[model samples]
Target: MTPPRDVAVVAYARTDHQGPAEGLSEAETLLPVLHEVLDRAGLAPGEADFTCSGSSDYLAGRPFSFTLTLDAVGAWPPIAESHVEMDGAWALYEAWVKILTGRADTALVYAHGKPSAGDPRDVLTRTLDPYYLAPLWPEPASLAALQARALADAGHTAGPDPAADPLAGPPAVADGAAAVVLAAGDAARRMCGRPAWIRGADHRVEPHALGLRDLTDSPSTRLAAERAGAFRAPVDTAELHVPFAAQDVVLRRALRLDDTVTVNPSGAAAGPLMVAGLIRLGEAAARIHRGASDRALAHATSGPCLQHNLVAVLEGDA
Candidate 1:
């Protein structure tokens, strides 16, 4: 079998995070970021062999929400395009595979969402089992709190129970957009001074039924990290897409990250619905690009109670 092709993140860009933009369209917010990431990679529109995006129609209240986002990419020439109804990290995964398969040398991955446009908890419910879970309309944080409680019960709780404060203030809400450029082999080295080569990337999910999963643990994350080779070595930095404080604890144990690893200097505040995950990838890759970290981990999670998890291990030239 051929050895896996080396894929690296060459450039990353994201908009300033903030509370709801009074009336900004998603396309308006993403256009500049699209141009900037491509420019950083020294590419023009449609220059990449493939382009993919991650987003959701539920957040936009319109079917085919991703098509409008295409306006930001200028698909006039009809590039090899695709989209995922997921966070941008998943979109990056698609592009990574495209390069690894030798079908493309370079690809652009982007994602945007305006969770501020509506009540996010209400929207996130759609990710649950519609037949049984969606009807409950349980907030994602509430599910996380259950995990917090379970951790405390299982003696896995590292510190104060994050669930103890149900009356605590809600999480910070922000609209966000992000883009990343990926290249394979020599192209990656040329596009970046210290390219963050993807040593391993994998995502896994547990059973959809809430009762079928162990709320106190993230086996899927652990398995994904194992498959992604996260435990093969220590990472100097970790950018985690933590939806709740308790989820952070769950992720730490799964990734086996110790204090030596710096976590989320880029701020993991959940910006919009799908953008935060991609931002995690961009943040980790940026650190490697700048020589700030020789090795790093970028994690993204979706679904209720960490039902789905993605792990990517990155390292700079040795």
Candidate 2:
């Protein structure tokens, strides 16, 4: 079944993350963004019908880490809230589902990451399969390099730059956070003069075994695009979560993006880990909200070598 209520992104805010952001607490990093998005939509804490977030306790190197971030949102008076271990984009998806279920008319979604706190590559290895991959302790960049090699062997390349090799890019550790506000129908129209309607949204995942899947292609992304109806209408722009240069080739082919679309104008070179993917979705919606495009595609990925993917199609009023 389709969404019960029309949903749109009314406001978005993200930290200016160039690279590593040291000497800042997670709450400090998130507070400004949370306030910015809410203020843009003229909202206050507990104003949104629901609140959700995405982050990794493992990245924080502690258990129940998200609870600490409640300080940033002023979680007193007890508001309905939820969180995901994945990218904030997934939190947004959950919020969208909540709206469709008629459980809420407005929602707040956000995500944050501080990868520079430790060896990011080694930290990421903790998510891999313990039996086969974790024991080997392969760096995240090494796995991307493997994917890049697979693509090259199949005659696919993202750019002529020598850094197109995944290893050349390495795992860029950045620290930051981002947030977005979602409203439904009238609530949306009232909050923002013109909302970025979520025309379609879906996510998919592939087998966990890196060796079992064809690294050159992202079947999960292709399936997500199909499920999200990404091709139903012409796309004017796309914001892709391409941390490493090589993954761009796989995403382009998987989504069938052409030169007609403006890809990642925000440069998306690097950002805080879990936050980057969600920021891509926010950036795409912002483009539509600002009248930069009639329709746009936002993509996010998780797991090693794009094992999981999320696709979103946003459209502005004609």
For each predicted model, how many residue pairs clash, with residues at least 3 apart or on different chains?
0, 0
lDDT of 1 by residue, 132-247 (tens): 88898888778776777777788874743555333354576788799999999899988889998989999998999989988877899999888998888888999989777767
lDDT of each: 0.86, 0.87
Model 2 C-alpha lDDT per residue in residues 105-194, reported as the tens digit of each score: 999999989887888888989889999999999987899888888888888755536556676757556789999999999999999977
How many clashing residue pairs are found in candidate 1?
0
Per-model TM against the reference: 0.95, 0.97
lDDT for model 2: 0.87
Q: Report residue 24 deviation for candidate 1 (angstroms).
A: 1.1
Model 1: pairs clashing at backbone N, Cα or C within 3 Å: none
Please identify model 2 stretches exceeding 4 Å from their true place. Answer: 158-160
Model 1 weakest lDDT span, ten residues long: 159-168
